[model samples]
Target: MKKKVIVSVAATVISLSTVIPLNVTNPAPTEAQETQQQPRYMTRAEIPAQYKWKTDHIYSSKARWEADIKKAELLSGVFKKNYQGKLAKSAAILKKALEDYSTLSRIQDKAFVYANLNADVNLTNPDLQAALDRAEKMATAVSENTAWFSPEVVEIPTKQMNKYLQDKSLSAYKYVLSDIIRTKSHTLSQDQEELLAKLSPLSSTGSDVYSRLSTEIKFPKITDSDGKEVQLTQTNFISFMESKDRNVRKQAYEAYYGTLEKFKGSFAQSLSSHVQSHNIRADVRNYKSALEAALIPNDIPVKVYDQLIHSVKKGLPLMHRYMDLKKKMLGVDELHMYDIYTPIVDAEEKYISYEEAQKQVMEGLKPLGDDYAKILKEAFGGGWVDVYSTDDKKSGAYQWGAYDTHPYLLLNYQGTKGDVATIAHELGHAAHSYLSKKEQPYLTSGYATFTAEVASTLNENLLWNSEYKKAKTKAEKMRLLNQRLENFRTTLFRQTQFAEFEKAIHELEQKGESINAATLKKVYGEINKKYYGKRMAADEEIAMEWARIPHFYDHKFYVYQYATSFAASAALSKQLLQQGAPAVKRIKEKFLEAGGSSDPISILKGAGVDMSSSKPIDEAMTVFEETLNELEKLINEK
Candidate 1:
């Protein structure tokens, strides 16, 4: 018999493409321009309609969304009645059952999308949050009803399953069926699967608690460089960290991390519980480790995860060299954590308006061909983006949508160069989803998390090159180069550090060790020390940094993809820059448009990057070393 495993619909929550949070800085307006330029909006209505997404595109009214929820719930009962025992009767019956299941899932997915998109824009609104709660309950019900699917399918006699697989009618679901069969050993009994699905709603308790605390916790005010007191906020903390004045950065860092420190106990509880849940699930599913449980569902090997940490650790000295360069450029006696974010070039930063950011993103992505250009134009004008930082809006950025609607992006776009890159990054996700939905069946429309970052990071790399080509001065080039190098630090090295920390915590839990605030801080601080090296001033606040990462609460084993995808994108972007149209053609056909029709590794290999080997990671580090070399040369020339 196949290994017993439970596949819950809750796993589908990751369809939303969220980028790892980066401390992107927005330029503060001068005092003289304060009256003319407001950096943030107090309400959604204060922003222009063009900058907001059309949530109505998904559902024209609340009544319509409610109707779909009811429709999905009703269909869930019908599905359980019709296909619960008849899945293996015949090839035609199996195909019909799968199609009906897809239809029901699509409706549930759409309803889930509407509630989440609304809740995200204004997390403070009770009505929206209530609606989101209802949507989650409905999704769990749908999952519970359809919980018999894989078990029954796996129970089909092997000879009969081979006949069904050979049927032309089931050709579209070929990969889907094969993957389900591949997990036969992991497929649990129908009763056990149903029970697990019933408990799926409880799985998100820790994540929900952390989300509320992170958004609701208030921080004290600090004096800005302009001598004006501004309240420290999650949205602007990064901006403060990037301030030209050392005192502003220091105050922001201390205030932010200090407040988080007060809530460390609660944060630690949330994280420990989250880790414990993964461990229990892994044990129940009979997996060797929580890491294996998380990776295997996505068809990712544990070795790939291990190799990322291994490769990144080998590249640590290069990161140290970059840090040493930062010390030299900033002329700091001690390179404290706060000093790391400020631009070392000492030049005034320019603000890029949302409209200007769109133009830059459009121009940057031009190499993807005219077909993609048309999609880009529609994505910009079709109201696919919700821009500007407004009160109660969610922090960070992501792209999400249903199969029936165009992809949508939620961004707190500040007029900064990094914000411009973010525009390109999120749009890459939107375009990938849009194309995949247009080309693939609903069952295969969503891509795996493993491959999600490839398009987004590739867009950023292209945007970097485009902006670099436009740089007219040494200072401008240096600033752009520094930003690129910073990407290597944050996206590649730093995320792997997070991945390592995540793995360590899960292992500790499996060993029956007690996990609390002190444990989390020690583990995170040690990892941070190794990655940043001895040059960084030892600060207790750095340990508290782990408390702020939302991904740890929401998604297990997710950060490593940022590192892996960066490596893959570096390889793909090189081909695009050098080979031009032919490379773009292959990437779209083999990668973006493939969706989840095949495993992530095979899809990427088809696109000309072999992630199974260390070549991509090694190549990416070489680029990082080369970038440091060029920057050093430019600095010496002066």
Candidate 2:
């Protein structure tokens, strides 16, 4: 998901995370002194000042945020009156107009992030929540006010726009101008665009209902391997799956999805309505399909989507081979769906403190050189992250910041190795934004998700390899290898399966077909059966998997970027390791610092991976097998 950029009128892309609702209740004051004490769990005040992000660097106080909001609101009206009919009058006018809009946008974004970051820390706060709500609408209102800008720009004939481009004064906006012209066909009239803007909030209705229901409904608790009861949650499902106990995995699976099954109709309707909303928007915009509408804005073609699904289907035999390896290594009589997540190498459990996690990340990113390492150090020490889970902090993790502020990370850090890898992954995002914002103007600072995952996942690969080389024993190496392989399997293979499922559903919706809970389950089960092959069984509960994936409701045709990004990053990671400094230099200069200065695919090409071809993906698939082979070698030796 793209980070929320509420500041820009030209683009208002908000990325959705796991979407778990924070259902925290305020605890009654203890008999002891009660001046803002921590809740039964930790509270916002209990978190160390160092661990919480210092947003004062962005804005000193809420008053400042409010003042900026007023300034932006004032500018929004002046902006429309000033540029509504005169974008093509002169090159100088066009340049100045864009610059002013950029300035107002930066202020708006800063205000938006300030309020929202405060709210994220203590989700139960009414004051900050209200401020955050106002900021969201204020930003959207500005966008709605400026809805005519794009269509107005599109009205200018390309030949005349090219003539305007002859002015060296507008050189900075060359690609931005070209992109507007390129997408001119999709640009609608001012009235139509405004209508769509008014309808935008309504589009999220289905998703909103889905989020509220999922968040409020409590799943059943079950016994862990330790015989103590554990609550199942979106955050801890995978953690439970990591247990050595197969029954624990089975019960967790059944219990989690079992709760989801009861709400299948509601979940199905929410998803169906969400997909229909996208389809309707695409139709109104004259796009051929919902997928085309989603992909075209990012400069991706239909064939890239087709090519990915095709290639993955062709590679199912290799996937099955990996599954068979898992079964053989586990020595199970028959591999059930529950057996897949069991760790093949039961290494001694180790907890890495957050301090050590930062150190390891800094050390692991060394191939990128001292400057990159220095950025990671600054991010760690500079209060650019909220490092612990207390009550009701947003679930899962994401890297979010306004163009004016440095990136702020939200983490629910346990001391597990996976947590360390997550630090590397998220810091990769922070570092990318840090570097890009330093080099590019506000208009160019935000990179697209298609290329964004490359930086994050590349860091993951680097960190895993760094740790793998240091493993003291075969068991340690196997654990690291096992962890690393699941990433490729999930990001490259599983997400492609997801990508294909999304395509099938969208096409079904396009044909005006009904897709209820049973329809979704049937399609999802068939895909899993084909992807996992005969070696692994698709649990009856597995079909209900679609019920919980936030991405399905959050963004249309979005998850494929994860697969595409991993392919590019894996290829680039190998290059950086093998080709050394030269490759590192190319990736840093061409990709990381590139930002949205170019289209996503072009930025990827500039970094040297041509996603238009399947070669990078194929190379990544090869690594998956090599990992299995190494695992087989280690296990047999043991």
- Could you say which candidate leads in TM-score? 1
Best by lDDT: 1
Clashing pairs in 1: 2-184, 2-185, 3-185, 3-186, 4-186, 5-186, 5-188
TM-score of each: 0.95, 0.92
lDDT against the true structure, each candidate: 0.84, 0.78
Tell me the tens digit of each residue's lDDT in model 2 across 1-638.
01123311111222211112322222233322143222223687765566677777777777887899999888988989998889989998889888988888877877887887787667667887799788878877777777788888889877889898777999988877777777777888989887887777878777767766666667789899989997877667877887788889888888998999999999999999999999999999889999999888777878888888887777788888878878877788788777777776777765566666777988888887888887776677666777777646666677877776777788777667788888988888888887887777777777777777788888988987788879898788888888877887788889999999999998998998998999999999999888899667647888999988877887788788878888888888888888988987898889888878888878888888999888887788788878878887887883
Worst 10 residues of 1 by lDDT: 1-10
Candidate 1 at 17: error in angstroms? 18
Candidate 1 wrongly placed segments (more than 4 Å): 1-38
The deviation in Å at residue 143 for candidate 2 is 1.2
Candidate 1 lDDT over 1-638, as tens digits, reads 11112111111211322222322333343442354343567998777777788888778899999999999999999999988888878898899888888888878878888898888888899999999999988888888898889899999999999998899999998889898998787788999999988987777788888989988899999999999999998888888988989999999999999999999999999998899889988888889999999999889999999999999999999999999999999888899899888887766776666666778988998888899887777777776778888768888888887776677788887677778888888877877887777778877777877788888889999999988889999988888889989999989999999999999999999999988999999999999999999878998899999988888998889889989999999889889999999999999999988888899999999999999998899999999999888888889994
Q: When superposed on Cα atoms, how far off is each prediction in RMSD?
A: 4.7, 5.9
Worst 10 residues of 2 by lDDT: 8-17
* Cα distance off (Å), candidate 1, residue 365: 0.8
